[model samples]
Target chain A: MRASAESNGGGADDDAAQVMGDGRHARHVTLKDVAELAGVSVSTVSLVMNEKKNARIAVKTQERVNRAIRELHYRPNALAQNLVTGTSKFIGLLTDSIATTPFAGQIIHGAQDRAWKQGYVLLIVNTEGNEDIERQAIRMFLEYKVHGILYSTWYHHEITLPQSLKDMNTVLVNCYSDTENLISVVPDEFNGGRTAAKMLLEQGHRRVAFINTTVESPARTGRLAGYRRALAEQGIAEDPSLIVDAEPTQEGGRAVAEVIRASGATGVCCHNDRVAMGLYDALRNRGIMVPSDISVVGFDDQEVIAAHMLPPLSTVALPHYELGASGVDAVLAPPVHLDDHRVLIACPAVHRESISALD
Target chain B: MRASAESNGGGADDDAAQVMGDGRHARHVTLKDVAELAGVSVSTVSLVMNEKKNARIAVKTQERVNRAIRELHYRPNALAQNLVTGTSKFIGLLTDSIATTPFAGQIIHGAQDRAWKQGYVLLIVNTEGNEDIERQAIRMFLEYKVHGILYSTWYHHEITLPQSLKDMNTVLVNCYSDTENLISVVPDEFNGGRTAAKMLLEQGHRRVAFINTTVESPARTGRLAGYRRALAEQGIAEDPSLIVDAEPTQEGGRAVAEVIRASGATGVCCHNDRVAMGLYDALRNRGIMVPSDISVVGFDDQEVIAAHMLPPLSTVALPHYELGASGVDAVLAPPVHLDDHRVLIACPAVHRESISALD
Candidate 1:
């Protein structure tokens, strides 16, 4: 295949020489080099490097090997060690476009911190939704003997597990399989939706509007159900007119502004922060004010938008960080049974200046 | 160290058993197993797996080995293969908080795509700015014998190289070292600033106010110089009153709203998209319409905010994706002389509704 313009490098043969060539990498300081310097056998140096307890090597000899290693700056080959130990202190994270999402950083941050504490390191591969790359990545992970694998997605949805993942110890994050085949961790979308409504309801807005997304997914279905449940708990009838469908974007929010204002709802719960931002623009254009004119609450309190909005939108968090951390926890702990493995982390509400109490 | 709340798993002892234990991982189907199934010796299986040229193995025996591998679902151990070949197809990406930045997704995406095309896999570790973790990650990458290392930051600036990175085939991305010790790739800050100014100047705006960041950094100095150069090219004098410093945030832009209006400039250039968004809000509240009253441009065309803004922002793109892809290219290519290895990728101007002719 022709290389992309950005690669801008020479052909494979040019790469072949430089792949292990003299220019980029200096000759690696190896175990034998250290062994020769320390006047010890290769195995003696290995035993010392591994800190093999009860090895019959003399203390003076061990000190000499350690000194030689420091002098030569030799790094023990982890691959060779993995071959002997049959295990690795690495967890492979294969994600479908998470690295491309704005808030994916939180997920990676949580997982990396948790993995680091447990004396393991996460090796992440963002597959960018390519099935071929995903397969190749999983195979590579297996070849490296990763302690476990975390198969994740950018958002919450149902996914079809790749056939290659069947035998590996894999946990699904932010996405699950219908076959009940893998342990999964995802956000509690239902509660998150309920949280948005409850925030508005607690401010004494009886006639609340839910600007639901038109797209069909777990978030759309689950959040709507949770909204209805919150209304039922408040002893209010579900008003079909107040529940309007939008595209779940800034434009979608702007498009539904007239419908929301005409419905006479004092407060509105948006599908997401982007939708809320659009509504803010539409409302500003129409000379309507937030809180005093119409209270608004958004879901997925995206930090860049939610916290930086004109009124600092009150919204529910997606628990993306928890989903990642839990994915790591699940993989490292004793395996949960396939039938009882779906774990849901709760989304919490964040109060800002967007909502106000009614008289 | 005590484990954090997120890692609600048992102690390391419990992890030890499960690390290579019965519950999570199935015993790997080894080369010996494949050889036994094929009724051939282990060396024959190895030779077939590697596709060694001029091997004396019979065609029938090779077919048997291949069939056994397919039947047993055996994945050739890449680590073991690396041990024999003394080369690896892995590149290590060590980042300081890039995963947490909003537009950092683009950088990782570009790098991953380029690396994949070259038959190399990227093993990314977001260090999150912890010095200890950064050192450990570098050591781990060294131990794994990664082909090269890409040390990246979320944004452009100068960085102190970690002591552990001194020996690796390392390339700095979106950052440069003060000592000129390594090859680096960064966004052309001066050109990016020039592009932002030229976009406004081309639209028949002579008096353009530049809202620069207050933070002392390359961006602050370079962009300002570029802005001056654009004005000089147009035979316009640099007006001291029109140049102002802000905190590079929405609030900062809002804080300078009155000053911008008072300066009588026909057009404005913002420090970034967030600042422009803030200025938009402030201008709206004061009954000033964008483009109609005063044209505006922003830097860092942050897609989520810039495209979704009321009037999609006209701004300069940061070339983050190029920085990452080029970092990979730099490491993979023959190393350039240290004194002449700083590569600057240009930031292009993106036109949108926010900019209009001054007339």
Candidate 2:
């Protein structure tokens, strides 16, 4: 417990009156006053307010106390009570762009749904990737005595943990730390990659080409790895010529159509839905038809893109909802390994209209 | 000043000590303890903490008290201090989907930026569009003594304002009331329509067509109104045959391509970018070149579609950022008229490669 020695100079217990003199807030109903009005002790008032039945106070006395409370309209200050109990029914969510990124809102939505079910209220602070503001927000959360904190980022990336977050109970969402000293809940991008490849392979395409994003992204590494693992499981040799590189946009996909066509691959797997859509456009412009001339698969089942694509893109989902809800669960449960706890949720394949079996 | 009379049974202000007896939380530092450590009075400690140099305490004595505060870590309880000042450096943001809608996060971001700059903290509650939850959330905000409230919706719609919100300082964002009782910040969709049509007309387009959403949506009414006004200004007789209806989606745009072509309007305006993209898709399938054989325009410059379109859609932007930022400004300012304060922000034109000038 973070506490200190109790030392005080004797004086008339006039703190409430002094605060009332300041006249900035509505006059609060203190326990001391409730006890006097009910002709009971301060402990009796506290017990009644907390709804402790063990005190065995008379029904009549309880009714009188309840009437006094109603008349005074004394609402308990959870913050003040948290000082004595050291338990706060509050969770603080720290995010970089969950508030600004439309897709990322699901993270907060999933977390809030779980937190509310557990009788905890969620307070979110969007730090907007500003380290100074992050530190300031953390201090504010500490002052509020939050039970735990969920630190999240907009995308899958590695982050330097804020030094101020060292001692607090926290869970990382959609990002990780090298130290492995904090509980991390991130998307299984590698699995998603495999899933995309599997979706294509299951459709009976051996010469499925992989259109990759920029080489530097961790997503690229993980997803490519998954794609290879899936191909290997089907007793297929890694085709060095089949793996192609493109920017992670529709134009990038379109620009690489020559490689896609020259490979004579019956199908293709794009880094994301955007790239897949771009490939679709490129093929259409080249007088090629999807699922008739070739099949295509994508990752990140972004609704606006994947669901609206002409053929309705067959893709791998990011598991955003699960990642968020799992982070909240992991923080509340606080696994036995504590700092070393890591949870990886699966990214399932969403089959729409883009993929077709070649056999 | 929503306050009540003080009523209670008081002994020696044993509230703090009794709460400590609950054996849960860390013992918090109090003003009495600070006064004793500083060898001054409790009032003096309060004044120093409140930074009231006018309390007449000697500078030397004040420094001593400050040192004592640092040593004791006597951070004031903002919740308690707020009682006297009536000003809480806190803002409450209530929404149906700020955390869930990607675009709506910008509203919070804009509001939080303003609030943080003004030394206020924002606590957000996502009510999930439930009336009971909305009411429950409002009660919680009231209990926290928030300085102001911002109620927002996911999309623009007329809302039955919650009865519980009448007394609190609140401003509606991206929505409106039938009664005009609350300050509302809504998108100027009508002007956006005018801008879209005007952009094409300015480029020497005489036969301009308007594709609209269902006539029920305020967005449709507003945008179409603007389109008609722009045509009327140019003395171009409104072509009733040029007006068409479609769902607000790509498919809807694709389905109406023949009508767009048959209307023989060199320049066409669809309800939104998605519909424009659909039209682009439909036209592409027919080998109709955008801005070559025909010119195209759209609204709600959704980044996913607009920025990435083959021709990069030329469309009208929804003023989401300004609408959110303005709501924060309005709530904090509490307009002189209080009720009936309406702010209409413009939706500007984002010109990309889609719209072409005629010979």
Candidate 3:
């Protein structure tokens, strides 16, 4: 609150007086003022503003109201319009790490793009992983009567639903509810893992290793499952030793290089791009060349890391933008009766230069 | 429009009917409904809802109106309240790349943090560097009558003012206006550059190279100037050859291996952490050890790149979050007279292992 202390001019009591106390302008412009200017009823002005011509006010009268609005710069109160129409052109984006993660901008862009196309604006609230903040944000969203709450997390994870969310039309993004029945949009981590493994396998990498996160993550688990499934389909016996765990970072990728070399794996599928970056370093340090000597693939095709890779990393795109856009689409769309509104967008293969086909 | 097609249920007309047509509910809750429930005039209900107790309205009548509101679950129209109050409790964040850049999330977080503590919500608009989008966003912000507009850029750059923003209270974050008089909150890039160079100079390195972006950038130019100034201060003649240009990425950093080798500079100040990541690779490739052989410093200490470096990277922090938070604070606070309302925040030095003192 101290942060905004200077912004505090007058509290609630001074609001009305301030509206009428503009000495230079005499008073703030309002719908009533516009109505008086146009010589029309308050309801007639509201009808013209809402574009609700169903009651059919004369065109001449409507034009006069419009002229008065422009002359006075009298913008209608969007909040009041929502009250009469039962429509709040605001979608609440309640996120834990949307404002902290590298991929955050993409998700928000997608959500904003979708919301605006529908004449709605996004109300963003970053809770920074505080349960109390999240609870309070939900309450605030309810008070504003947001059309829906887009509950998004920075990364893919499970979450405890805020009790306030239960009473609202809430959509989960990059996360899921504890119990089913809630709508969710999340990336297909398993598919991404399979895609990474398959890319290496198609490049004649029979001995492929997967270096993944040491931390227990759904992405890690799901990716591993897909990796195993992809290998199984190729009639390769499951070699659990080929799968190793690291911190899911550049250091983690580097740490697992010895294991990869010891296992005699000719190719590697990293958990994500950061891990792949480390692998590139570790391999280069050991004088192990990429593609020719060992091929590499990664998940989450982060443009900054993957594009800047020496040969450009071939990885699975996380589809975070699609997740946010589709999540908004799903929630804002007409209600569908699904067993559970769980939609998984694909993490498609982004084949760049890292993999080479063996003769 | 196609994006929100499903969410669009008969536009404005369907709103009132949708509430009343729920079948389970025979009539929608409205002011008339509340007034009837309380046995009071509609104006009395309005005065009560607005809390305009003016001493004329009896205490008993006010209590009846309050009970009716709770019983009917009547939510006051926020837009109307805003119209009366001249307070929207909403701030517009007009950004070109908040949803695209890796550092953007930090900026949004800081802005959101500052806004919320003051009971305001951020309405995000990612213009994606489109002029039309930017113009439209500005108009929308004006229509909503946002408390203030936080016009931000993905990177540091100069932008032409949008015509729609001509009459609005707007603050620039991470950028500035062409002329004075506009309030701006931006990171001191020159200071950041100086910090990077100073860190290397303090480590007893006389010969220092600055690897900067090939493409023109405020950061690249500012950092180069600081690098030159630092060398000149030590009476080390500014060697034009010591200033190398690259793509301002890892690949670009890696490509400068031969120049670094030939220049004989024992210390380097990279434009950013990504460039530093590349240098680490190029140096390691040639068996040139960091710090022991050549100390390195960088700007924009990106956590993923700087923290994950083999020895970690010492760099100057960008302070993007502060730019956003303070930008909001500046705009929301009472106006102060200045040649230009420019507030520069310091980009402090961050020490890591990439730099070392010479024995």
Candidate 4:
């Protein structure tokens, strides 16, 4: 491995030598040198190298700058620039699981997509849901002097701040901290719940049931609040018996569905997509037809459930990509002037064929 | 930000003030000082500080060393150590999508789990499915002087690497490169296929169809190879008509089912869980019973699809978590003799109720 390493590095130097136009050795080529070689302004060379030369310089001039950069083997000194500017151009994304769940991955994509457009690199760390590991990861980020921290959680829960991170600019995604200063961005669960209820109610369904996991779960609570809000907006009285709490699994959905049938509810709103999935099986086993015997709606618009349900599930969609993008925005935003901190992103409703109009 | 910056360096000194136990102005409290204070070796202090001292020293001695290190507040100079040793404790994980898929998340979790256990930190970057971006990210990894690289692709495809990465020790996860010398740990696609076929054959199914997206996809090719091998072992002649290519989506599964029914196939295997979802819709629409009229199997065992399918889907599971963990292992493994390269991991099969006996 070491033998090949020396040869490859030597080969790179040789390749550069072949591309050199003159024997003039300046040690490291700068933007000014590239500009001089290309016969363009230094800023013009910078713009061209940064891929922002469009509309600022003629296409031919841009081409010349690029050619000069390639000929000189010019590489930007990102680390030195970061040291001088005190901004690393690196955003530290602390995710509990960046690669485990589709939600976190989508969020990272949205955040990175925006960050890259703005010429920033993401220093992502997957903590794997361990608090001690997370604390150590954050300490490393601080040592690296990252510009901001985007703390993304796998589930909705209270987050504890690392001592080293107490002073840093941070934005929490899908989680909240008791600390007063940290900003948080989460999906609009209340709106999602309200939308699910409105969709089923609009289909002329009365006596709708809300099947959820635990009231302790913030997402469940927010969705339940939205359901109540929507019912009140429609001048319908909220019934406590219609709301059943169960686990957020297939078994949970199945168990709750049985209760829904016994309660004589013709429409059901699930806390999230997974619950909706279980309802499908329970309904099927009981010879209940979705959108025929009863209408069903879910939240989160999880791709597998929404698309694959016997009747494609009508559900409220969490703007996960938007949540991540906006979380980055929150972290990068100027420090909050006041103590009150909250950033709620809108969760839009997605309509499919799961709900049928009651005759 | 500037105000905080000026005060930041001073706070450490002030924090160090509390450690002046000897009355000799604390002597700057370096690692050497900690070694002297604890009356133990410097390497022992390092192992203790980094939490690797558990196995190396007696428990009482370890506690004494830890207490001394904490009292001194001697933070290990990570950057200085990296520069001196030429080994950054950071591992670079390069992925095509940062936050879009659940598979990537599981892989990351596994990698992070292993990395944490070893006291190595992962520095992750998302490539956004663009070759140019991937090249830039890898270059950044090189510039950062990461000890190793873990390159994960969103889909199974051959990747052309940057020249700078030619000498770098890298482990390809969920993807492979044509380069002969690179070590890669990819999911065992052939085994996955064979497992799927064996499961169906064991259930007394004489004839089964393989529904895939494309003939050229590596995952499909491996699976097909496994399918044929299983059939051959069972003394069944391979049927060309049994292999059907369809889109790996819900609509695609539905379309393939239409073709499968016309061909009189009694059992079907899908390229992925998503396609299996489409099969569910098609089967339900035609009023065909699952595992009754036809038994169906899927791959990738995506949670949403497996749980919600009218009858939960039986799928050949991709060891996503193991893939990540194994990639880290390959990265951290002592360099295999300068010549040997390539590591392949096996994917385990998971059975649900999606398939049934033809008897």
Clashing pairs in 4: A99-B104, A99-B105, A99-B106, A100-B105, A100-B106, A105-B99, A105-B100, A106-B99, A106-B100
Per lDDT, what order, best first?
Answer: 1, 3, 2, 4
Q: Native contacts recovered by candidate 3, as a share?
A: 0.47
Better of 1 and 3 by DockQ: 3
Cα-based TM-score, every candidate: 0.88, 0.84, 0.90, 0.75
Instruction: Please give, for every candidate in the order listed, the TM-score of chain B alone compared with the true chain B.
Output: 0.88, 0.83, 0.88, 0.78
True contacts recovered per prediction: 0.54, 0.25, 0.47, 0.29
Where is the poorest 10-residue window by lDDT in model 3 chain B? B19-28
When only chain A is evaluated, what TM-score does every model earn? 0.87, 0.83, 0.86, 0.79
Better of 3 and 4 by TM-score: 3
Put down candidate 4 lDDT per residue, A270-295, tens digits, no spaces.
Answer: 87777887788678767788888888
Cα error, candidate 4, residue A17 (Å): 24
Q: Is candidate 1 or candidate 4 better by lDDT?
A: 1
Q: Write the per-residue lDDT of candidate 1 for residues A1-359, one digit (tens) a residue.
A: 01121122323233333643544345455566677779999779888988878898899999999998898777678877776554577788888888778886578767877887887777778887788888888878888878888889988889989887876778899998878557889888888888889998898999999999998888999999999999999999999999999998899999999999999999999999999999998999889999789999998888678988888899999988888899899888845453456788998999999998987
Residue B251 shift from truth in candidate 1, angstroms? 1.1
Off by over 4 Å in 3: A1-28, A32-68, A334-340, B1-42, B55-61, B334-340
- CA lDDT of each prediction against the hidden true structure: 0.82, 0.76, 0.77, 0.71
lDDT of 2 by residue, A52-88 (tens): 7888988888887887677666666554455444345
Q: Candidate 2 residues B299-324, lDDT tens each? A: 87775568888878888888777877
DockQ of each: 0.42, 0.21, 0.43, 0.17
Q: What is the C-alpha local distance difference test score of candidate 4?
A: 0.71
Q: Write the per-residue lDDT of candidate 3 for residues A127-218, one digit (tens) a residue.
A: 98888888878777766767777899988888888876764667899998767457788888888889999998887778899888877767
Chain B, model 2, TM-score against the native? 0.83
Error of 3 at A132 (Å): 2.2
